[model samples]
Target chain A: MNMIEAAAVHVRFGDRVVLESVDLAVAEGEFHGVMGPNGAGKTTFFNVLTGRVKPNRGRVLLAGEDVTGLSPHRIAAKGIARSFQIMTLFDEFSALDNVMMGLPEFRARSHDVARAAAGDSRFAAKSSEALAAVGLADKGDIRAKDLSYGDRRALEIAVALAQAPRVLCLDEPTSGLGSDGVQRLAALIARLKGRLTIVAIEHDMEFLFSLADRISVIHWGQVVARGTPHELQQNEWVRRSNLGKFA
Target chain B: MAAPLLVLDDVRKVYTRGRVIRRPTFTLQANLSLDEPDIVGVVGPNGAGKTTLFEMMTGSNAPTSGRVLVAGTDIHGVKYRERDRLAIHYHQSYQVRRFRKRIPSAFLAPSPTRTPLVHLFDEPQFNLQDGYIGFMLDFFRKLRDEGRLVVLCMHPTAAWHLDILAEIAGRFLFVAGGGVTAVANFGALVADPRCRSYLGPEMTKAADAICHGAVHSST
Candidate 1:
């Protein structure tokens, strides 16, 4: 069964439709990549998954359970963790603290635990491990406000990883990174393969090509093509669309 | 020729917590000449003292030794109120609680005496949801066109915003361990041979520094 399934979903704002009859499914432990131009409804799709937007029509299923109108927090509780295109780190908080905030249902699950225990040596170890996984292990204590841009992006990924979710969604993970930085992120994603299901929206074709197991092209709020990276690379229609430039 | 935009001479800082003395006297002497717009990238390892250098440069923390001059004027010599009036520091983890709120008009407020140089410690890592990233990119561009110098201190992960940084600032500075190892125009910096070599090392350091503060114990 698919981990996440969106069937014939439609989303509109006033007279404009952002997503029209879009159908997509994420298999267990699959690394899915969504590629498109601006206004192609990539972010709108994320909104639908997180229940930030109620689809005008159609249904969303998580692990075979219908969740079309569930709240974002509820969806998150159900093992979905998303990192924004632009980072949402807590500036005043330390990097470790930011990752702690991303822990799944920690508030309720660890309520009985004392504050000192919450900030215990073990928790710190886990946070450090997450930081190191994203190549930010050394920056655990620096305030979010003090990091450089590339490091901040890595921290965002670290926060998502901290959730230990079954599904991970990343928006434009390589949007502003230089070539080397993009390569590092791709390497990190590659390492996480098979352990988690990933759905990423990205514009950088090079990085996506290297990291994505499957590619879905979105345009005019619809799924124009879906295939393995090589298949999508050869599709005639994809060749004619925005994917051509990247090709 | 047009007066150094920012100058630092033998700047030193010491962190002493009781008996534990960490780098009691770290020094950096640099002459930064910014006659036009520039984007400087400060790169360093965690505990390499990147933030400490920024603090001393921006006057957020006083240096144990040496002088910092901005626009041919000694920043340390100026009164705190006057310095505050002349500088704007945007730290990382800068949050935008409201998406609808307009960009602070104070950012665009006129400065008749000298061109305002904005310091963004980690502006890109802040809340960038709801088109705010585009808004900030455009805003910084305008500041650059007006001849303002914008300095951004970024960790390796936040390095993706360099495109926006390049569009806004013409020059760049890469600081590591309370010192600048590389300085150039945004274009030149990207193409610089030294930038690639030093970027990874400096980023690792910055990340280490952040981790040190967050975990508060050995990894």
Candidate 2:
């Protein structure tokens, strides 16, 4: 069964139509990539998938159940976790603490973050495992603000991983990273590819072309083109452009 | 019989300066009927009211006079939220414009069709670097094949851009000097004096080459 599906999702912000009948289906363990020019509503589509924005029409199905219009927290609770384009991390807390906060077990015990941070052993172990998955196991004790940029990006993923999510939605994961950082991030994502389902909206075509099982080219608030990297590169213009280097 | 796909009946839009004096700054007029499903390319210079024409066709901007009919339904009379169901206007990446909702949607009728009969793409970015042109061109053809009229408006800055319009569009509309002229084919479009002036020297030469079979498109 498809793990996550957006069925004809339509979102309009007042007079401007942002997403016009967008349909996307990600099979289990599929690493789907979304690419588009700016202002083409890529982020808005992500918002719809993660329940940040409610669709004016159509439905979002998670494993065949209608979950459209669910609250963000509710959607996250149902095993769909996301990392934002803008990093959201606790600056003063240790990387371990940041990941622990996202743990459902830790949150279930208490809303008192300070008390929960000191009272957990199993949660801490799970947090450490999550950090290790993102290659930040040794950086667990370091303050989030003290970590390097690349480490911070991995730490954000670690935070989502701690939730044991079925699907991970990443928005512009390689935006601020340098070439080396991107390479390391790619290696990390490669390790997790088959184990987790991922839908990433990325501008770096080389990264997506190398990693994604399939790519959807979004334009005019719709999926204009979609195919594997090889299929998309078959165009005459694509063979001549810099994107051809990936081919 | 089913109604014509799209009809612009004596449409006119005038933008006036000075609310008190109301002196007209610009005026655009178009009266055309496209009765079949096909790709129609629209080309013109900047500020030639092409965007205005598209907005009016999609029912976002109400024509100063006359009507825009999509499958015989008056698009402007349809509810604002439902207008896209009859005719959707896909704006250029940078060209985001909003028009006032003068009448409340409560008073307007719902869209007559579930899917749009007319699809207008305004200056879709055809970047060579992205190489999505082939897919996009195929999509336009797919829409036409499904029996929907496709209106593609583009400013052909490069020769390849003109090649795309020639290879894809069956007919052409040249918007200039506050009027719309329908050119029967790529051959006629390059030969028209106004279109030649709009295309300028370099592009006109390239277009002529395409018309004369000297330039072969790689598509």
Candidate 3:
């Protein structure tokens, strides 16, 4: 059964139609990639999936249960967690504290997240496990700002992982990373591929094409094309362009 | 027998400057009928009123004179918020122009359909590297096959851009100097002297190559 589905999603801001009719169905444990040019309504579609923006029409289903128009916090609690394209980590907080702050248990228990992270053993263990999943277990003591750019990205993923979400929605995870950073991130994503359902919007075509089980090309606020990486690259124009070089 | 998909019945739009003097700065006129489901390519130079023409077609900007019909329903007469049900305009960035409402939405007629009959894309950016061009072209065909009129307005800067326009569009509308000229096919569009001038030397050569069946034979 499909884990997350957006059916005929339509979003319009005033007279401008942002997403015409976007339909996507990501199966359980599948790595789905969403790629599109800038201003193609890719982010808006992400927003709709994660409940940041509600569609003017259509439905978003989570495991056959309708979850459209739910609040962001409600959606997050329902096992859909997301990381932002622009990093949202607290610069002054330790990596562990950031992850702990994301833990639902920790958030529910105390409003003082920084203090609670250090005092609570269960929360600390859970945060450490999340950090280890993203290869940041040893770097938990360091402040987010002190970590390398790559480590910071990993830490952000760790924060989302702390939620133990069923579906992880990543927005431009590979952005602002060097070649080495991208490779590390790819390996991390590879490790988590089968264990978790992932939906990523990425500009790094090679990264997405390599890791994604199936990819959807979004343009004009709609899913313009979709297929496996090999199937998509078979287009004559794609073969002529740099994207074909990946194959 | 069924109402034509889209019809611009002698539509005219005039943008005038100076509220008191009301001197006309720009004017665009179009009279055409797309009776069937097909992808119609729109090409023209900058400030040739392509954007204005799209606005009028989608009912965002009211025509100064005539009617813009989508499957026999006059879009201007439709409810303000529900106008998109008849025709939707995907603007470039946040270039959505706001026009004054002449009549209250309660007085306007409701849209006859749920989905837009006329889809007008204004200069949608087509990037080649990501390989989304193929998908977009296919989507245009899908909309056409669903019995909808798809109007694509593009500013052809590259050779491949012209290739895409030639390949995807069954007909062409060359908008220039406030007038719209409809061409039946790609070969005819390239043959017109005004279109040649608008395309420039490099693009014109590419367009001619496409017309002679010398390019993009792969698909």
Candidate 4:
């Protein structure tokens, strides 16, 4: 069964249709790649699938369960988590605190200064473990503001991973990182490949081509092409679109 | 593989602020290891500790914790003048040149010279004519050809040598607010989505173009 699927999903903002009856599906444990030009409804598609947007028509499903029109929080309860294109870390909090907030169980309680400050606590241990998984274990005590851009992104991913989602959707996951930052993030994502079902919207042709096991090109809010990287690389239509230059 | 020319192991620097209530600050923390002839390109947003890492590598600033070795020599324990035997620091004038970071007036206009195993170019492109940048790039490349490690520290906003570095450098060290992460080599670096994400779209696009052209030349 597909991990996540959007069947003929349609979304419109006022008179303009952002996603025009789009369809996308991520297989179980597959590194499904989504690529397209700017304003092509890539993020809007993600929003519809994650429950941030209620599609004008069609249904969304996760692991064979219908999730269409569910509020974001409700869908999240159904095990879907996503990272934003912008840096979503709390600048004032330490790396540990940021990941701790990602924990689904911990986010319910009131903010606790004492627990956040205590390094040896269970919450801190869980937070630190998540950070360690992303190669930021040593940066747990450092304020997120002090972290490098790469480390901040790593912390962001740590936050997402801590949620223990069955389906993780990444929107332009590697958008703001430098060469070094990109490699580190790719390494982390590569490690997460077989363990988690990820749908990444990436514009970096080189990174996306190598990272995604199956490629899907979205344009004008539609799934224009879907296949292996080799097939997409040779698609005449993809070669004529904005992706043509990069492919 | 060639013997590692630069090794920074769990390096950390702490600073004290607030005269009324001063506490140690963790200003820099980096763990990087690179081999000889590696043109290590370091770039990040302002306050990312790119310069300080150069300083630490050059023995100008002592790390609060961890070790910095050049050609297998621990630089912090060495004498001041003797320090240059392995590294030279070309300081940059940041927008806010904190009192301590003030590059002595005499050293402000100093030119880069090849005298050490590692050359630290801290904002070398600052206050220079366009022509000098090309010269500096060639200078950096020449030293790399001679098996020296050239660590170029660039400001995020400044017009960096994005194409040149992408075409030549083998490794990249990204420092954000003092913490550092290593990207193994140029090929692996370019294929990272974060390259476009963290470095911004324009620069990453330019680097991708440059890397594409370089593949032909390198082959």
Give the top-scoring candidate (DockQ): 2
Clashing pairs in 3: none
Q: How much is the lDDT of residue A190 in candidate 4?
A: 91
Q: Which stretches of candidate 2 lie over 4 Å from their true place?
A: B16-25, B92-100, B216-219
lDDT for A57 (candidate 2): 87
C-alpha positional error of residue A76 in candidate 4 after TM-score superposition, expressed in Å: 1.9
Candidate 1 chain A weakest lDDT stretch, 10 residues? A235-244
Decide which is better by lDDT, 2 or 4: 2
Q: Write the per-residue lDDT of candidate 3 for residues B1-219, one digit (tens) a residue.
A: 999988999999998999899999999999999999999999999999988889888888999999988999999999988888888887766787788998999999999888888888888877776566777788899999999899999888888788889889999899999999999999999999999999899989989988787765333
Instruction: Write down the DockQ of candidate 1.
Output: 0.01
Residue runs of model 1 more than 4 Å from their true location after superposition: A109-118, A236-247, B1-219
Q: Output the lDDT of residue A34, model 3.
A: 95
Clash counts per candidate, in order, are 48, 0, 0, 15
Q: Candidate 2 chain B TM?
A: 0.96
RMSD of each: 20.5, 2.1, 2.2, 23.5
Give every candidate's TM-score on chain A. 0.91, 0.98, 0.98, 0.92
* Tens digits of per-residue lDDT for model 3, A86-118: 999999999999899998878889997657866
